[model samples]
Target: MIIGKVIGNVWATRKEESLNGMKLMVVRRLDTESGCEQESFVAVDCVGAGIGERVLVTTGSSARMALDNPNKPVDATIVGIIDEVEVRAEG
Candidate 1:
């Protein structure tokens, strides 16, 4: 799982057949401790997450499970809309 912020939306007129009714959003991974920005990627959103909201993203095969479709061609999906996040760092 990755902690990220929803940055924007993605609309595609043509895509894989399995992704016909899915809502895709742009997510920017965030460093929990330093609050730094990391890689950004498009994710399938099924939890009704909105822009500027923190969300939990699952990638790879697990993303397919998040969509409840084992064969969906999704690489990333939003599993949850994060309510809050707290992290502990050790140096």
Candidate 2:
């Protein structure tokens, strides 16, 4: 899973038949604590995440599996909305 923030949304009137009813969002991956930039990618919002919301994104085959619908035609899917993150760093 990837922790990221929703930066924007996407709209397409005409899309692939398998992607008919999916909500799309632009997500930028973040660092563990500082929230530094990592990468950005478009993802399907399965959890109804909005802009500025911190979300949990699943990528690749795991994403497709999360949907439990093999024909969804999604490469990435937002699985959860993160409220907080706890990390322990050892030097």
Candidate 3:
């Protein structure tokens, strides 16, 4: 699982049967404290996350497992919406 922020959204009128009702959003990783956005990627919204919200993401095989059918073709999926994050610094 990866901690990320939903930076934007994706719209597609036509798609595969397995992905017909899935919502797609763009996610960018952020620095724990500063919230500085990093690399961005598109992910299928399985948990109804909106833009500007921190989200938990699952990738690869784990991503498929989050969906109804594990065999579906999906690379990334939003697993949860984060309410808060606590960061601990190492001295």
Highest TM-score scorer: 1
How do the residues 1-91 of candidate 1 rate in per-residue lDDT, one tens digit apiece? Answer: 9999999988898888888889989999998778799999999997999999999999998788877767878889998999877775553
* TM-score-superior candidate, 1 or 3: 1
What's the C-alpha lDDT at position 42 in model 2? 96
Model 2 score (lDDT): 0.89
How displaced is residue 1 in candidate 3, in Å?
Answer: 1.8
Taking all chains together, the TM-score of candidate 3 against the true structure is: 0.87
Q: Write the per-residue lDDT of candidate 2 for residues 5-74, one digit (tens) a residue.
A: 9999889998897787778899999997888988899999988898999999999978887775866778
RMSD of each: 1.4, 1.5, 1.6
lDDT string for model 3 (1-91, tens) is: 7889998888888787888878889999877788877888989999989988999999988899888888878999999999888887772
lDDT minimum window of 10 residues, candidate 3: 82-91
RMSD to the native, candidate 1? Answer: 1.4
Positional deviation of residue 63's Cα in model 2 after best superposition, in angstroms = 0.3
Model 1 whole-model lDDT (C-alpha atoms): 0.90
Model 2: residues with Cα > 4 Å off, grouped in runs? none
Rank by lDDT, descending? 1, 2, 3
Q: Model 2 misses residue 34 by how many Å?
A: 2.2
